[model samples]
Target: MHVLSRTLIDLYDAAEDVAPNEYPAVVMAVMHRLISFDGALLGCGLDAMEHARIFHRSPLLPSDYAKVYRSDPLACRLRLGLRVPVTCECRRFYVARECAEVKRFYQRHRIARVLLFGDPPAGRLPRRWVALYRGVDAGFTRNERARMEEVWPHVSRGLTANRRRHLERHVARRAGAASALMNRSGMLEAQDTDFRALLAADRLDVADGVMPERVRQCWRAGSTYVGEHLQISLQECGEFIVCTAVPLGCAVKLTPAERIVANLFASGLNHRQISERLGVSQNTARSHIAHAYAKLDVHDKAALANTLALDPSRVKTGRTE
Candidate 1:
């Protein structure tokens, strides 16, 4: 194996040793070793609701997060493209200079060489953007981009898998937590007692020691899936095929305005349509929706509807912004 390839393998193999909060540094370390960068910034969960966490190892970063992160040029570029695939999705490689926003940010930070990598499609989880910078005049080379492309698949799986396992536990605490182990065929090779109870509550039964047909279908769809009344997130934990099954709890704690937004949202309305229906501004509608999601402990419109027993398929394909 090439030295860089071996390093990636080692980094992923040791991912569990790092805590979720501190893992960004490890990822940055790997990127630094491979591409030789001066500093790094990693953002996860970039959504219009602004449920994001950004970690930076940059020089002279502002002490106040609001001063540094608010109106962040990069986050704006990213969340602004949440529904627009062509611009939101990076082609496994990026040079900051290629983007005017990135160019301006780099110049302001005195950063020259730059590279950003997006999550692999298979993860289908959060939108993660990793930025690495160099202070001198040299820019990232094609060779380095090629190297990053080679290693990104493993990195995406490892990083997201670890992060999911960590965050899913929090979700579980807020709702009913159940877990199951499945084989390559999506058969339930093992399951906790709570897993059976959680599924049974919604009339989903384990047939002949295998996962339900609905679950098998969802598994085929992606690593994450939300059934009509339950949302399950999956990840590969070592040799274990693990899943966190969170029961859909409509224990939504929203204000009256947010309740209005939630009702409009449940009817499959996007931000703009919801605003028009409620006679509110788009920003106001978005704010209410964000608050509703936070109160319900859901992430996106689809998940929100699923939890609230709403039919999201009826939603028009309108951008949230």
Candidate 2:
């Protein structure tokens, strides 16, 4: 809850030093500081079978990875599954009993360590490995180390949730572009080369303009229309939303009356105006929002909006169970 420590702040800044490739190193270094690890190893899978990029661990060669890649129990689990989280202390018996290749590699490197294995969000990994290793001698005290283990579940859940948000954003963007193309694809069929280019340009301009209006509509809805999902532009649009549409996931669903209220809210209607428009009392309008929060599974309007905008794929189906 407190602001990050000065040391962490410095580490955060330093993380920016290496554009993107340095992420693992920065993460390893930061974690090393936080947890007091002897040495850390980061091996991230890139595009599945294209070969994993190994960093941090020294004298732990590619051959070691190659051997592990084919036979390591953790690696096997990761490759076979979608996403999983595990923290386990692995000894020589693990290598010897599980896989011969792992055993041989372990014998060579004297590899006996506890490992935290995580699969990054779908689409985030293979580009990132499912396994992370920290040498045992890392100076973490018993209590401090236990704290790390205890917090890991929550931290992993948060990270996974964040990754899902990112994935939703990406998929929605692609869907928007595809939808725009489909609208124009009909026209492009009859156009000549030059005409087709002009049509294409016009469509791009129109879609670009339309996206902002959509964002504004979502933002203005306020309490009535909890913005569980929206697509906003990220670029400089004096009139447009942002350059891109964002999908915010909501925690709850809205009822039909609530949906109407939300639409009115987005239209910038005041409570009195909404009541008059919907032919309901002012209290009724207020009640709609209150009920909307319950149905939408949100604590507040802002959170509702954020959730909606971040997770566009969420369609209010049955219960969220």
Name the regions of candidate 2 deviating beyond 4 angstroms.
1-12, 15-17, 46-56, 80-85, 95-98, 120-127, 130-321
Give all TM-scores, in the order shown. 0.43, 0.37
Over the stretch 224-302, how does candidate 1's per-residue lDDT look in tens digits?
6665557777766543356678765444245557766776787677888877766789999888888878767689877
Compared with the true structure, the alpha-carbon lDDT of candidate 1 equals 0.58
**lDDT (CA) per prediction:** 0.58, 0.43
Candidate 1 clashing pairs, residues 3+ apart or interchain: none
Can you write out model 2's per-residue Cα lDDT over 136-251, one digit (the tens) per residue?
A: 52332455445444433333333333333333333344443322111111111011123222223323333221222333344455222123433233332121112232232333
Best by lDDT: 1
Candidate 2, position 162, lDDT: 33
> What TM-score does candidate 2 reach?
0.37
